[model samples]
Target: MHLKDIIWMGGLLTVLSFPVSATEIEWPVYGGDNLHQRHSKLTQITKNNVSGLVEAWEFDTGINATFQATPVVQDGVMYVSLPFNDVVALDAASGKQLWRYEHDLDEDYPICCGPANRGVAVSNGMVFTGTIDARLIALDAKTGEKRWDNRVVGDNTGIREEVSRLDDSELGSVSGTSGAGINMAPMIYQDTVIIGITGVGYGLHLDATDSDSPLGAVVGIAGKYGRRGFMAGYDMKTGKQKWQFDTIKSKNWEGDFVTKTADGVELPRDIAKERASLEKYSDAWRYGGASAWSTPVIDPYTGILHFGTGNPSPQMEGSSRPGDNLYSSSLLALDANSGDYRWHYQQVPHDSWGYDVASPPVLFEITIKGKPIPAIGQAGKTGWFYVHDRRNGKFLYKSEAFVPQKNMFELPTSEGTIIYPGVMGGANWSPVSVDARRRLVFIAAIHWPVEYKLHQQPARNGEAAIRYSSMSPLNTPEKHGLLTAIDLDNGEIVWQVKTENPLIGGVLSTASGLVFTGEGRGELMAFDADSGEKRWSGKTEAGVNAPPITYSINGKQHIAVAVGGNRLFGFKTGQKIKVWRLP
Candidate 1:
């Protein structure tokens, strides 16, 4: 792929609009654009020629952490953020480093999840990113020089360090150990950059019977540990906060305490018991853990920024804090300009199980009942693709379960209850791709079931009162990844592919009738977008746990992905970015 063929002859230093140009393609945002579609119009590498794709170039960032950043390309320059918030700019056509920005973080920063960064956002003349220290920073796009840095969280004192030390250092010891950190790519809208925090609601994870195998179990210990999660918009020029929207609503946090979901799915919630304790736990929303783990997608016409929220605080045990846990485990729509709440559709209310809406919400138009309507769709951890009216947050039809569903919404028992699509989810943090022309949404899912067991006895160390759940993965033979193609017109799954390992990364679809995704087993495969037939597969040194993106340099299309496997999930880890093109 040479840069001269499709490169629009323009000033080399010109700061162009997001799309870059008419002939040259650019992946300018986290989701390629504000719609979060993860789709490209380039078709030079079509299905017929996809098998001939060969390695174009590869860049090693030299740091080997859980790499999940999706490189953003624009005007022959590609920007990628490595784990630990290090930003690197590279030439899109060749594997050459342009500049690098090294971020310095405090040693004592609180972090609960794996050290992974999503990517970086480039706008005007600056590159923006959020860090593991809960800070937002912007750098000069040309030289990779720091422009401005601002802290996202106000105070870290809210972290529970005192209460955690008590209880014989077991029941509440997890608090203050790790809290809020920024792991997602920032979104640029107008003059504001949008970002959010994650890991605040995270609990201790227990190793399986064998550390070398896949995760055996997870446990969400109860405590007032993390702070309330939020998403905010900041002034791009000054890095000053413009507006903020808390995921947990302070006033109406309880809402109507509905026992069923908006789609009429009966949630196993004790409404009367929750209401009886409402007053005592009314202020729990202040410390509620509804982390915003995905980037926000904006509707250019309506100015609504949509994203999903994580699980509520003290995950898996809703005894102390109850009443629907408003907004957590929900699809939230907010006014992009003012950060005002618009509407929310909760996926799991008073969620005792960790069913976070971790997938990025995709925006598109769907025809329902012979009527076209603006809509947003999200592949949920609950094993379904949920569709909703983008204008009013109304429930549109949902696709059939892409993965196997067994004992869904069933409460954890003392004897250990099995839940399909467990904590790893039907769709975890992996992003989905949409093909508007084909009317199909490509989703990467996991079929791992977890054994959820509630523990009512005191800690073995005779710690404070203990009541929580031990979520262990059933490392049996049936665990695998499900790559599904769902037709939006009739909510039917057209084709599904199963993999030996769970699909934790993201997906990309194109006009070339191809779908691309990475597997936990270190393979990058391209499938026929229409028939779900495997067209080509290449092995990277590490697992490709990040999303795949396509862009054009000299009329030759190229596919790029970061091959840093996930350590938490036992996927091999490395620090490599591989780009492929037609030979």
Candidate 2:
């Protein structure tokens, strides 16, 4: 049956005073709902019996690439997106393949990162995905047939022009890198499907540091490169462009040039030089690079959608772009239908260290001063959990540092400077899960510090000389994973669990008092939600580097995660989706 028909029937039955079906415990949206909580209400697999959990079935897509997609299930049917933007449907109860749709991608499609498609969004009996080539396509949910495709961001000619203008030495294997393309999962709100691009603000990266590292430093070649990144809405039925919100603003993109963060943390900045060069680079927003990579959460009641933005262009070198670079490294709220800006909170202004707001915002109610206030919270790369008023973007409070912090906002030196919670951050692109009942938030974080160094070269002709910077991964004695639980009440850490390697994917919370997450070491485990105790663990062939999701069929709950590890982080690669249930 179609999704609209199911919703219609369910609403009708509810109005007719009939009981709702218990089998309707489905994960219909990407974060399990419009709020992006990533929490399930199923209690069939409680903490007491979770130790008996065993693999019920495993499905391999036969594509041995980095698999980061999270499966969305509805009515016992599961849908997942494979790397290179392929879509597949499966029987959630049996792991049987239903249908598959492979994308006919352009041979010359350019991407700054690996071939990873986060997942797909389903609504109105159709599934939607954004391609690496910067296009959005809709498919028949049951048959996996292409309905329509829309090029949200056009041709590579602009990207090629930007690359051609760069110096040969500055190219650094970046000629093949296109500025913008979608790596995030699409979300359907009302009748519009929303998605955004990544790699727009990415600097030229090379294997100069070490081949073992998944990603290297962003070599600074200062010039106008990378198109302005945006989050756009499309007609779900026809794949038509609806409304677009650019992360880079045109006028007044530069704020008051504050030297400190919104929370009053002092940041190091060369204010005199920046203000002196403001006019020369006033048009930098035209080529600004605040890529939107995470999925947005919508408050259905308020009709407002909230998401985060990445760093500015010519990353790690702010000489060309001055002022706060408004909107980059920010949490933005927009009107869901019209895409009009409601409010924004800039976490790091004129971010020179590549500290973008990579994690998605989670919405919930937080009580303050004996009054319940509607709030939104996001785990930041700066190692802080920021809580804000959902209605107006007001700073309510911030949690203590979830990961270690050292030499934050320090200038890159020619002699090399070490910084904790480096560019990869206290929390990377991984999403965090929240338990609203207990007012606890869970984060899978990394503690890998980075070394920042400056690079300078003479101008070739009468042109301006280039000044850039490079960030290399430091071989520190302590590089590990931190699974932290923070109580939202007083911003105190409840408990923290350290892993052998850094955590990347995300977390899932259940009503049965269990927190489920994966590690880079290929272990999928369950923890006591309140106490942060490792209750049970299971091993996969490769790293379980994607988010864990839970859904039930025939009153039986299943725990599932993707085991296609991330190659960028040097994790073992595999192509399997393993589902577990209490046996």
Cα lDDT tens digits, model 1, 155-234, are 76235524332222222322234478888899988999999998767655543232223454556665565667899999
Superposed on all Cα atoms, the candidates' RMSDs to the truth, in angstroms, are: 5.6, 4.9
In terms of lDDT, the poorest run of 10 residues in model 2 is 14-23
> Residue by residue across 353-472, what tens digits does model 2's lDDT show?
889899889998988889999899999999999999999999999999999998998988877799988888898888898888888999999898888887655677676665667777
Full-model lDDT for every candidate: 0.84, 0.84
Candidate 2 stretches greater than 4 Å from native: 1-24, 156-176, 207-213, 458-466
lDDT of 2: 0.84
**lDDT over C-alpha atoms for residue 470 of model 1:** 68
